[model samples]
Target: MSKSDFGLFGLGVMGKSLSRNLAQKGFKISLFNRHVDEVEVDVAKNFKAEYQELKNALAFDNVEEFVASLASPRKIMLMVNAGKTIDIVIDNLLPYLSENDIIIDGGNSNYKKTKERFDYLQTKGIQFIGTGVSGGEEGALKGPSIMPSGTKEAYNNVSQFLETIAARDKNNLPCCTYIGPEGSGQFIKMVHNGIEYVEMQLLAEVATILKHKGKNPNEIAETLDSFKDDANSYLLEITADIFRKKEGDSWLVNLILDKAGNKGTGNWATITSAELGVPNTLIASALFSRYISFYKEHRVQFHKEYIKKSVSRLNLADDDLLKAYQFVRIINHYQGFKLIQEASEKFNWNLNLSEIARIWTNGCIIRSSLMEELVSIFKETNTILIHSKISKMIIDCKPSIKRVVSDCVLSDVTTPALSEALQFFNGITTQHSSANIIQAQRDYFGAHKYQRIDDASGKFYHTNWV
Candidate 1:
């Protein structure tokens, strides 16, 4: 038989779906999943048997056989757990692999670790591609936005298959690209999740405010569905579906717990932003919202103790809500891309913001009409705040957000992400900030120096205050 064109090392949900997608695209792929005795016996075998598209796939429980089945200059993708498991899989495959073979990491891994691996693989004469695959299980089976970073030569070797299996944009072009070198793909994906956190939180806040105004699940779903403009997105669509889901006449969304769970990407994004000295208050607020949700017992007790006699009604219109959502979303996207820009400069990645926005225009969870607009915006200017079109939109939408945020506050509604977004906007746009007082206070006690406003030479002055 002819050797397989590609090889995969994990048969989990994502791995299986990707393998099926590969096979469906006519790439003969060898599949392998480690045998875990009774727990995961015949994972690869069963996966191939279950998926008709993978009829000709080579399934192997033995690592050596799986490695040997692939053609020379092998391309193996690891879909295993991130962190230690990635290293473990690479170590196992190293003994069987030849020089110049490529290994792709397809999980949500930390970019720092990916860079380390990329460097380590180079010494062994093997190429490593750290790729970020977005869109959930469904997108994996159909198509997903793919961000791949490695040596240009290595990416060229794998571009045909990667592009073939990626989601297409409105232009019918694949939603995949060469992001940059040394883990920039993973870093971009991290920022994507950060923006995702704020987006989800914004939606939840809107739902809560609407529910407080006596809107039912179906009503809310319809209300959300009516946002046919820039607010339209994959996340918004899924959220509407979630609201409409019913379980024996009861809305499934209500029965579910108030707690939200995250798998570390949000935290990583927020941390990276702070490390890079970028202002990412919206994402931080969103991450904290999830943390706050985890303490259900404490929340309940605190709520009862702090309960007011009567809360005012949110008197904002659905139009107001839509305006607020769009305004906050633009800010969130700007913050996310700004973080990426800082990382690119610091790491010398030379990451292309326009390409990143373009790939995220489809298949990704955050894909939206806004992302479609951002593709050109980033091309014209890397900074969204300075872009004439976006700046004008922000200026026009400012009043609606103010009205919505003020109403939510008076009505005793918590809109952390929205409120933080407004604050971030205000802080960023201010010509003279309150930080001068902070600098003076710091100089008073800590001997810290302050820069003069009139100084064009970028000099600092230290003052002694009694």
Candidate 2:
């Protein structure tokens, strides 16, 4: 038979699913996994047994054989863990790869590391593409949102396949695009994950608020279902399902541990935001909330020590809660986009914000009705907050958000995501804040200069007090 069209390394869940998906799309695929131990070897054997029935699918135990089986100017996608595993795969594949052969890193890798690898591989005439594949296990088997970034020439070799296997929106547009050179794909994916964190936390807070008001899981699920028609989102939809799920005699959600676990992407977003000097307060609060949850014992003891009897529940309207949710969702999306905008300029990525919004409308966890509006709005305006339409919406919704936050506070329930979002909104909208006093105090103590409102904007004045 003819050589396989492309190759996939690392026969893990993602790698296997992608191989099958590609094969079903009529592209032949050669598969291999590193011989790390008996478990890995057994996984590869099982993969070969499962797909050997398909005429277009091939599997090999040897890395060299896998690379050699691919067509000329070989294209191989690696689904291994990020960091050192990526480097190891490249090192092992180099001996078998020739000029113009391509390697794609389809993992949650750091963009900086991707750039370093791209540069390092170029020295040996091997093309490197740092691509991000989103949409969990099921999406991998069917379709996913694909983000690829590398040299334009390298992208051309894989663009067709990437687009073919990517999920499509209602308009049937593929949820895949060439992001830009030097790790732009990974950077965009990082922002996607960051937005996801904030969204999840926001939903959890809403659920907690409902539960505190004597709403059972089913009641909460029904209430969440009402938002499906308006604020329809994958996250929201699944949250409803989670509430309705039963385990033994109790709700599955309640049975699950309170502590949330993360795999570092959320932390990466917070770190990158600080490094970029972007105020991503909502995302930061979401990460901190998870860290706080880990202190289960301490929280339990604190709750026992601070017990108060006969605390009354604050009465809140569902409309107000819904409006508050919408407002905070918009804020979270705005923060992610702002980070993307700043990173694009800082890294010279030349990202298309509108296209990014369009591609995110499907497949990804953050996919939502909001993305559709964002695509149109981004095309017409550079800064979303400054847009008259969006500005008016924020102004109209602020009262509802404030009311919701007030209720949460009075009820002694923590709504960090909502509170931080409100804080962000207040900070940006305020024309004159308490910062004037801060500037004066700074000047009074450390001789830091203070900008005078009466003077030119950049003119600074220092005062001495004895």
Candidate 3:
């Protein structure tokens, strides 16, 4: 019996799958968990057989003992909970781990926290890697998009193993990459989850309306069926199946609560966006919606407050809803790009937006057929996407889309989730606004200075109107 090459420090759903994957991929696996019961001898036997003739591998009680069991210059992955638990494990494990022993934090960790941990580990002369693993429980078992960030040496240490186990893009490049020096990988994944929030909310709101309008779940499922033919993502494609299927007797989604639950990544995105002074109102609103859902009393109060005022009642035809749905989807896409732009500026990450869309085509939540087309739109056009082919689709559907928006306003049909996104998209793409000019005029008149856009120093321009 001897130490193994790869080790998983947590054996929750994700950790277990990753361990099995590494073992199946022919790596000797050293697995450990806080709970001894989670580590089974039968599973150990399965692993030994899966990768026949492997070196001796065993599970341990805690991080201290686990790190002690590993060979010199060790490689152990911590797939435990993201925030507080990560710190606890790293603190305990740091004492036993020597230099060049790469420790991979493969969880949905916040990028800010990732950066902080990187700096802390550096003080101890240890290599710390933070990777963003997407594709839920199943993906973790088979393969997942592994967005890793840390030092160059750290990436090289485990890149080959990561590439072998990671999910692939259309070009088949392992979904794993050295995103940037540190924190960039988690930051990008944060945006990915934010986009996911908006997408699901948009679909849920649409479902709410359709169900209320007396459309059977099957009929709605039938509508989703065509989405897979040309342009589709995993979420939409699978949602269609969920609606199309009949369990004991109800739509699976209907069985679940209308309220959504997020794992803090989306909230992290929204919070970071505000910190960067970036406008991510749509995603912010979607995140807010989840919080609002929790306040059952407030929702009841809101209904009573506006019940007499006639709020959020849509009497639109089916065509209008479809057009609005398509337009809102485009808006969400554009907003996602805008957030990426702001993030790039803030982090100096130099992210390729189109490549992001491509990678997301299958492995991530925002994957869609339309993303392939949008990728080309980004390649050809250097300006705002409002003038691109995606925007042109909006243009063709403008009449009905506008009718829907107008209906939302007049009838007080609160299209808050979708409308806010559309408006946010429109506000950014527009060139002139009398309101902006007036506000700037007032600022210059009162303060006698306006911030200069192209100045080497912190200079202000003074313009006096007679």
Give per-candidate clash totals. Answer: 0, 0, 4
The C-alpha RMSD of each candidate to the native structure, in angstroms, is 1.1, 1.6, 4.1
The sequence of per-residue lDDT tens digits that candidate 3 reaches over residues 360-413 is 665555767777676666766523354656667777666776777676667655
Query: For residues 1-466, what per-residue lDDT tens digits would candidate 1 score against the true structure?
Result: 7899999899888998899899999999999999988898998998889888999999999999999999988999999999999999999999999999999999999999999999999999999999999998989889999999989999998998899999999999999999999899999999998999999999999998889778899999999999865579999998999999999989999999998999999999989988999989988999999999999999999989997556766778988888889899999999999999999999999988988999999988899999999999888898998989888989888999999889888778899988998999999989999999999999889988889989989898899786
Sorted by lDDT (best first), the order is: 1, 2, 3
| Model 2 lDDT tens row, 264-332 | 788998999999999988888999999999999999899888966544675788778888999999899
Q: Whole-model lDDT, candidate 2?
A: 0.89
- Those runs of model 2 whose alpha carbons end farther than 4 Å from true positions after fitting are 51-53
Can you rank all candidates by TM-score, best first? 1, 2, 3
What's the CA error at residue 292 for candidate 2, in Å? 0.7
Give the per-residue Cα lDDT of candidate 3 at 438: 64
Backbone clash pairs for candidate 1 read: none
TM-scores for the candidates: 0.98, 0.96, 0.85
